[model samples]
Target: MTVLASSAPVLEVSALTRAFGGLVAVNVIDLAVHSGEIVGLLGPNGSGKTTALNLISGVLRPDSGTIRFAGQAINGMPAHRIARLGLARTFQLVRVLKGMSCAENVKAGLVFHRPPLSRGEIDESVDRLLRHVGLSDRGGLPAAGLTYIDCKRLELARALALKPRLLLLDEWLAGLNPSELLIGIELIRSLKEEGLSILLVEHVMDAIRSLCDRCVVMNSGRRIAEGRPDEVLADPAVIEAYLGVSPGVSTDA
Candidate 1:
């Protein structure tokens, strides 16, 4: 895979803002994500992390902003159109067809706004994706029967079926146990090694600290800081906004 140059951002957002009525859900925010890197977006609930992802993935239109992916404007493009442009995102909510088999569910992703392929091709493609996500043997099972963690993995696999240049993931580890969290983290790491750029919105501190090369913290619809994991996590502003004060942690913000 061809790696992207550091100077040229794979995704860029300038002055992104979204509002509903009199309330601003996301204020003017600017961000740039380079290829082959994982950048975490974290904050308290309603901090606009998911909203930011929605805007980038074209699920919701930004009230004012410019989003350029690979040098092309995609701010107002529909979600399906964005996917065709090598961007794909997974929802915070698990969106699986309960009655469908795992293989069938994965196949759905491949057909997202794309021309249909032959059955044999779809099967081969889905099987390869399932294997990549460590779900090869589970493909024949119904989606509803899989455990919560497996379901999450299935979602990741489906997202990868798009062969995206950039992926926006929203809080995928929400309901997972410790073991599941580790597995999920490992899978994300593997993807990064495969040269996929990622922007993840997650609250799990451990995952963010371990998986992301850098992070951006948001609070009340505004950016607080952006830097390496340790530097950003240790920032007084981030700790105050998310972790709250403790006797041992710094109180100044």
Candidate 2:
């Protein structure tokens, strides 16, 4: 796998801003993901993590500022268009085609890729992806029948089918048990090893510390701190915003 230096960012957001009515969801946030880095996005609930992912993936348009991927300005582009440019994301709330089989749902994802594959190729790719996500035996099952963790894996397989250069994962570890979390972490690590740039929004600190080379902390729609995961997590601002206590202040009675 090719290692990405910090200077070569594959996804760049500069002064990005988004708002709904009077509520500013993302306020002039600037972020970047280098070609092979897994950057963690950390914040308390409603700190604009999902909103930022939406903007980056084109699920929502920014009210101001620029979003560029692979050197192309993608601001205002439709979600499909952005996805076709090799950017893909998984939702916080898993979304699968309830009526479709697992293989069919994965097939739907391959439709957006350039130079469409033949039927046989698509089928083969679907099988391979299902195996990669540990759903090889369940390919014929209806996605709706799968458990919550299986749904997350299905979504991940679907995202991988897009053959993305950059992936935004929103709370993918939220509902997983310890063993499931280990599998998820290993899968993500393997993807990163294959040179995929990932932006992870997760509440699991252990996962963040294990998977991320760096982290950005957000609060009230603004970035509060950004640095190495350990450093950022230890920042007084981050502690206060996330834990509601000033760093170094004892809570002991």
Question: Stretches of candidate 2 above 4 Å error?
Answer: 1-6, 250-253
Candidate 2 structure lDDT: 0.93
Per-residue lDDT of model 2, residues 1-253, tens digit only: 6465456889989999999999999999999999889999999999999999999999999999999999999999999999999999999999999999999999999998677999999999999999999998888999999999999999999999999999999999998999999999999998998889999999999999999988988999999999999999889899899888897889999
Score each candidate by Cα lDDT.
0.87, 0.93
lDDT of 1 by residue, 1-253 (tens): 4343365688988999999888788899888888888889878898988899999998899999899998999998998899988898889998888889999888888886255678888888898899998898888999999887788888888898888989998998788889888988988888888889999998888999888888888988999899989998888888788766633666568
How many residue pairs clash in each candidate at the backbone level? 0, 0
TM-score per model over all chains: 0.91, 0.96
Indicate the residue-level lDDT of 229 in model 2.
93
| Top candidate (lDDT) | 2
